[model samples]
Target: MAVQDRGERSRRSILEAAASVFDERGYDAASTTEILARSGLTRGALYHHFPSKEAIAAALVAAQSEALMVPEHPVRLQAMVDLTLEYARRLRSDPVLRASVRLTVEQSSFNRPGMTPYRQSADAILGLLREAERQGEMLPGVDLEELTQFIVGAFTGVQLMSQVYCGRQDLMARVSTMWRLLLPSIATPGVLMRLRTTPPPSVAGAEGDGVREGDAETDGTARPPVTPRAPWG
Candidate 1:
């Protein structure tokens, strides 16, 4: 049990370290030596848990998926929005994902596959939107899939823009502005009100339902085109 525990801890450490490295150095430039050094583990320890560098990168993304997924709160729709924005917040702030921000660009790679970080991210936010709509947080005419794409696109664009043109100070502000601009129109007032009442902004980070989602457009060969550029931008 102790050995197993150590192994698990080692794996987690590697994942966290990888996130840091990926954020700082990115996939193409990052090295296993750096990840090991960051984790304070030897190569043997890292290899015991993961087979290859690509596996480690994948593990890092999976870790981000686990850490940054949207929360399910008392008000379902706002929880959905809260979750979306929170993901936006983390993508902008978190180093591991900031590096993968490039992953947002090659839709062919993310869209083509068995499961990539961005796809999982898209699916998760989409699920929240669907739940919000089903529960009357959104009006009847809502198209959950299309709405999900709008959201995913907005997030992708925001992160990508910050990557390119951001002045380095206001990326967070930019992200929040995007969310504020989008949420008001997408989520219904009743749902929005209920969410606000249930979870004030202060404690938002502490609560969550622990569910993660994968993207809807990904199918291994090609991505489905469901959502257009958000009407907001």
Candidate 2:
């Protein structure tokens, strides 16, 4: 058990270090030696976990899927908004996530394969939108799949622009603007009023809230139930 635990720790160290290097220097420019130095792990240990630099990059790309903590809300649309807002907050603080975003965006330039992270994110959003539609939270005639694609694309652009312009310091604000613009078109008026573009004060302070990867539940805060109002006469 000790040996296995040590191995796991070693692997994580390598990945974190590699992520930092990749975050600072693009994939093509980041060197294994720099990762080794950052991790303080021997060449043999790194090779034991990741055989090549591309493998490290692939692992980082895959890690992006775990970055968002999607809480369950009675209203699927509210949950979607929470997911985006929380993700934007995280983008400002999580190094691994930032690196994952960078690698995913630059994958074509780096000649790496597998966009599983992007597909997984799209599928998750699509599922939420589909549920929102079923519950009549979405606008009539809304295309769930197309809306999913649009949200994902818009988020990617927003985060990238935030990173480029303000070093992501204003990501949460930018995300709020995005949600304000998108909700009117995607959600029913009642749902739109109930959804919050900004994170609640508690949630904002808990930006560093340490939820484990793959955990679907929120950190015990009660979310408001979705209440759809009657359309205006």
Candidate 3:
């Protein structure tokens, strides 16, 4: 029992330590030796939990991406932009995510494993958009997949821009700009209220992306209960 408890503590220590170092130095500059010294773990132990630095990096990305899927809050956004904005906020706040962002921006290759964290994230956003369409929370005239990618990809672009320049604390204004530009077309006023009122809480951040990825893979067979929608889309 003691051994297992110690193992868990060591694992968590490494996770936190890595987050701190990566947060401070960014990913490419972070080294296993530095993470080991910070976490108070031996190299053997660190290697046991995460086989490679890239794997550790993937774990970090997974941690933040997972946060976006927490159960809907009362004041959360019901429209597509609102949903994506919540995710962008989480990415901004999370450490592993910042590293991933840094890596994606700095690195030039799609062949790298580092790309996987966000690889499926875009798909998840599109999945939710499709579900919104099915629930009648979206207009009837749009092409479902195209619109989903368009809306989601647009937010991704906005978030990347904000992250590259403004940092998370000031991101809301830019995300709000994206929201305003977007809302006029697809989101009804009622839908916008849900978004404006229900920004995702920090507590619910980083909880359920894997379940959602699975849900999306099954063609949303396990779609979450729809957030309340406006009377018109």
Candidate 4:
């Protein structure tokens, strides 16, 4: 293997192993030894990618946002909704996201030098909200910054609650309900009527009921054409 490719593989293995350890033991109890064992790598290999446990934790937290990727929807608000739902769905199976959430909530246990994961998540949603506003999907006078923060905080709580109650088996439904309650306050009346609370079948996985047929364009506002964007996974 090429030198760079071998190095990249080792780095990915270290991260994956660290994610599992963090997800299982959390930041306070997770150790470099455990991660090294999980990765089946030598001490040198592990340290080459991550300097310490804190560095690994920070990396995981930074990567949490990657799991929120979803395809662009014509309705920017719908895309925002899909973003949260996709995250919820991923929490059930994605170890990186789960570990990231664990490390984020347990921030006091470690030293996180850069921006917090919550801030990154809020920034992403804020960007979407700005687009929604430009497209006339949001209610007038809505403060995008405040709304973005609230959505991020609320999802954090909802997902944590779901995690404790049922191991996050119900996260998608809980997040769907979250959007249902909050959409009325922030979305235009026309947009509110047509926005889907549930994810589409392709993104929904097994727990999701998926979007119903005729669910789109039911608000009598002609579905505005949207420029296609790159798909997120």
Candidate 5:
């Protein structure tokens, strides 16, 4: 048990260090030596956990899939909004997520085969959009499939721009602006009115508290706050 626990810790440490290095230097430019130095682990230890730099990069890419929490909401449209807002919040603060974004965007440079993260993200959102359509939250004539792809593409662009321009500190705000523009086209008036562009205080506070995804839902207090942000100017 002790050995297993220590091994898990070592593996996590390597991944985190690799993430930070990848986030700062990108995949091609990031070096194993730098990752080793940042991880504070010996070469043999790193090799034991990750045989090669490509292996570590692949691990980081896979890790991205689990970094965002999709909260449960009575309204699936609002749940989608919360998922995006919460993801933006996490991207601003989580090194692993930052690294994942870097990996996903720059995978071609590294000769990686596919953008698995983007596909997975699109699928998750597509599921939500399908549910929203079933619940009549969607505006008339909305095509959930096209809308899902559009959203994934738009979010990728928004997050990339935010990262380049502002270090992602303004990501949540940017995502809120995105939601405001997109909601009118995708959601019914009633659902649109009920959705909050900015994350509610509970969600925002929960992010800081390091609560796991769905914790807010389990507590049954995931409702949007009284004063959601007005649309960006």
Candidate 6:
């Protein structure tokens, strides 16, 4: 038990140190030696947990999805919206997620392994949209795959703009705006009315406002659920 716990701690230390470097320097400029130096671990220790710098980058990329996992909301579309808001909120503080995002954009600089982060994000949103469709929340005949890809692409553009404009300090607001413009076209009218386009205080400014993410409410006034309208001929 002691041996396993120590190994886990060491692994975590290496990942955290690597994340900080990657977030700051992008994948091409970050080095294993610097990661090891920041981790305060021997070369052998880092190599034991991660054989190469690419391996470490891959691990961080794979973990980004975990950080965005929101609790299942009663309204599935709301859950989808919350996932993006949570990601925007996390970008302010989560080194791993930031590093992963950096690596994703710099994919041309280095060989990124396994599934791309964009695909993973699309898959997650597609799952939520599928659930929302089952619950009659989406407009009929909308292409789930195409909509998922567009949502992921739109978010990528928004976050990049936010980062350039204000270092992602206003990313939550930007994401909320994205949903506001998107939901009307994709969601049932009643579902759109029930959804919140504003990021709750927690996602907008949890640290500054002293509100917890859990305290954010998902519910609005109940309205009769409306069936989706068929596509126009």
Best by lDDT: 5
Deviation in Å, model 5, residue 73 alpha carbon: 0.9
Off by over 4 Å in 3: 24-26, 73-82, 108-111, 188-233
Candidate 5 per-residue C-alpha lDDT over 1-233 given as tens digits, one digit per residue, 9 for 90 to 100: 99999999999999999999988888888999999999999999999998899898888888878855667788998889889877876777678888878878874556563758888888889999888989999988988888888999999999999878967767777887888788877777777777777776665555455644433222324543422333431
Per-model TM-score on C-alpha atoms = 0.68, 0.86, 0.68, 0.83, 0.88, 0.83
Residue by residue across 12-67, what tens digits does model 6's lDDT show? Answer: 89989999999888888888889989999999999899888888988888888787
Per residue, candidate 4 scores C-alpha lDDT tens digits across 1-233 of 69999999888888889999888887788889888899999999888888888888778887887876655898999999888877776677678878888877865658853456888788889989999999999989999999999999999999999999988777776887788778888888778778777766554333244422222222223334222221220
lDDT of model 3, residue 76: 22
Better of 3 and 5 by TM-score: 5
How would you encode candidate 1's per-residue C-alpha lDDT over 141-189 as one tens digit per residue? 7677887777777766766676678523344445546655655666666
lDDT of 6: 0.78
At residue 188, give the lDDT of candidate 2. Answer: 80
Enumerate clash totals for all models, in the order shown: 2, 0, 6, 0, 0, 0
Kindly report the root-mean-square deviation of model 3 from the true structure over all alpha carbons.
9.0
- Give the better candidate number (3 or 6) by TM-score: 6
**Over all chains combined, what TM-score does candidate 5 have?**
0.88
Q: Write the per-residue lDDT of candidate 3 for residues 1-233, one digit (tens) a residue.
A: 99999988888788778877877776678888999999988999999899987777666666656655634533222544455555655565556556555555455222245545455666666666666666656655767566656665666677777766855554555665666556545644555545542233332343456322111112212344233344455
Error of 1 at 203 (Å): 2.9
Where in model 2 is the C-alpha error above 4 Å?
107-109, 207-233
